[model samples]
Target: MTSTLILGGRRSGKSARAQALASTFAEVTLIATATASDGEMAERITRHQADRPAHWHTVESPLYLASALQQADAAGCCLLVDCLTLWQTNLLLAEDETLLARETDALLAILPRLQAEVILVSNEVGWSIVPESALARRFADEVGRLHQRLAAACQRVELVVAGLPLTMKNETGTR
Candidate 1:
């Protein structure tokens, strides 16, 4: 099994790229880590749902991502995680101090050992100035740390900018 991490900023086409790659596999299960707490977010989720193929299965696990991954992963199947940023946000907003760390650790431990091809999408949020709010700062710090750990665990790491993918790391040194 191969694992890939796709990192990009807002509107950088990270989701499209991950979906396109997953289309190559025989079967795909999208592990959506988003919750529509508001109308705008609900619209976004709907749009994403419309963009996917009818045959592709979707699993929504806003706070229980590791469990979803564990259940969906299988040989010859591909698991596409839309965005880790949203998952992190969900964990942070939960107000539970230990949830984020525990889930992050569980994900890191599970990724490298999965039997299916994994495509994880995350936002690159640390390029701009530091945020004034404590919550914003914590979010950036946590996402950065998560990205680093995921990159190390993934076989391929790609950075997307303006809808273009730039390969940062590849275990086989090709593709």
Candidate 2:
């Protein structure tokens, strides 16, 4: 699998970039990690769903991301994981604190085995000032660490800002 990790702040065009890359494949399976827990979230989810092509398969996996990838992965297909931060939140809220590390470890371990082209979108939470709340701070720290680990595993790493993508790492070397 040709793995690419897209990191950016909110509204940085990470999803759009991932979608464009995935569209180049013959088949696409989108592993959506977001859930509509409230009205605004529902609206956002609806908008995203509408934006996607009807032919692309969507899998709602607020948790159990590794299993979702295992099931959706296929040769000659692209598996686009839209936002890993939400997945981390899901794991942090749904299970014991240890679950986050366990699930993240599983995801990293499974990446090498997946047969599909993998494009993962993640928020760059560490770029801003430290969050006020303890939980928020912890989330930011975990997400930052996760991005570092993912970048190491992925063949391509990009930082999207102002709707532009800056290649940080490629097959040749780390940019």
Best by TM-score: 1
**On residues 1-175, what C-alpha lDDT tens digit does candidate 1 reach at each position?**
8999999999999999998999998799999999889999999999999998989999999888888999998999999998899999999988788999999999998887789999999999999999999999999999999999999989999999999999999995668
List the RMSD of every prediction in angstroms. Answer: 0.9, 1.8
Residue-by-residue lDDT tens digits, candidate 2, 1-175:
6899999999999999899888899899999999999999999899889888899999999888899999998999999999899999998787487889989999999999999999999999997898999999989999989999999999999999999999998983434
The CA-based lDDT of model 1 is what?
0.94
Measured with C-alpha atoms, the lDDT of residue 162 in candidate 2 is 94
Q: Which ten residues in a row have the lowest lDDT in candidate 2?
A: 166-175
Q: List the residue pairs that clash in candidate 2.
A: none
- Per-candidate Cα lDDT values, in order, are 0.94, 0.92
Clashing pairs in 1: none
- lDDT of model number 2: 0.92
Supply candidate 2's per-residue lDDT for 67. Answer: 93
> What is the RMSD of candidate 2?
1.8
